[model samples]
Target: MTAPAPETEPTPPPGRRERKKQATREALLDAAFRLFASKGYEATTVEEIAEAVDVSTRTFFRYFASKEDVALTSQEEQFYAVLDAFRRRPPEESALTAMRHAGTLLIEALEVDGLADERMSRFDCLMRLTEESPALRAGSMERTRRKNDEMTRAIAERMGADPERDLRPRMFAAMASTAFMVAADAYRMGVCGFGSFSEAVDAAFEVLEKGFAEY
Candidate 1:
């Protein structure tokens, strides 16, 4: 008797469609960044970005709610990644030490991923855009505020303090964030040059460890 015919492989269902959507979303982000850097964020229209990525205006909206969202997507992930690292610090470490370690790890990862240059480039564009556009400025502030909240919770957890009752965690996190931003700004402005982003972060943490009393 002839063997029964082998069943044909089943086709993938709707989940494959979701992955395609994600790829399209990332492509849109890449296209948007390129346009914003070259043409200026304010002058770059949604239609232009959609066209650059070979998608319709309606399709762009399906991925990003607005142009501002494009500037913020990767930054949000970076902030959360750092906060998560801080939250896992050893109990023996001081809050400041924990933050320094977390920051170092984050910088290392950025460098490893070859995102340091890209991040600086995007940040430069974002700074310029925010300075010129009130709407973009508001979006930037909102992103910072959200990151601050996440850092506060991470600090509180690391210190074994109640996030609701203790103000120290929030204060420390705010100060740490401020220090990091100042260092980042210095690097961007060419005030300090280092071999790698991690080196810059290490130098900044050293300065912080030395205390701002000298400043």
Candidate 2:
């Protein structure tokens, strides 16, 4: 369990209006997932999702840019969170160590926090939806591809290495991304006797650290 340092600044709570806005966004997201799961992603419409939440089509656009955007929202959130975490790690830690901690820390927070159960349930729906829709999977991959560059640059800056000259940052970024997905899937499937999502993530990064000697 990663405990917060006393000196680490706490994130201020969102204002009442922001909380209300977030609630509406979540409601719209849940409604979209439910409709997508039932009606098929290709068949689901933004208007239908808004109707499910008793909101208008224009309101849906206010929250999500498009139907695809809503479908990939949770995933994109995690990616950015990981990047933020990676950037915040102590400077002395190696890139891989920093990434592993960053990834696992975020996953652990997700499992332990107040919103844990609800977010995980949402992730479950998203995973199943992704498997069923080739378009969603492709869209997700494209987003990951674009986001990985940001992660690679972050890692490069941490190491004070030239990203254009050194490939290590790119490798670490790609590996961390893959490890995150594999760990989440393993935890969700629960076939390997892992106890939590963070445990799965820790194990995934350990294999990389050891150069897969155990495997």
Quote each prediction's TM-score. 0.80, 0.90
Q: List the global CA lDDT of all models.
A: 0.77, 0.83
lDDT tens digits, residue span 56-107, model 2: 9999899999998998888789889878887888887788888888878887
Find the candidate with the highest TM-score and give its number: 2
Worst 10 residues of 2 by lDDT: 1-10
Deviation in Å, model 1, residue 200 alpha carbon: 1.5
List the pairs of residues colliding in candidate 2. none
Model 1 is weakest, by summed lDDT over 10 consecutive residues, at 1-10
lDDT of 1: 0.77
User: Against the hidden true structure, what lDDT does model 2 obtain?
Assistant: 0.83
* Candidate 1 residue-wise lDDT, 103-209, digit = tens: 77777777898878887777777777778778888988988887888788777877789978989988887788877777778777677676765566667777777
| Candidate 2 off by > 4 Å | 1-6
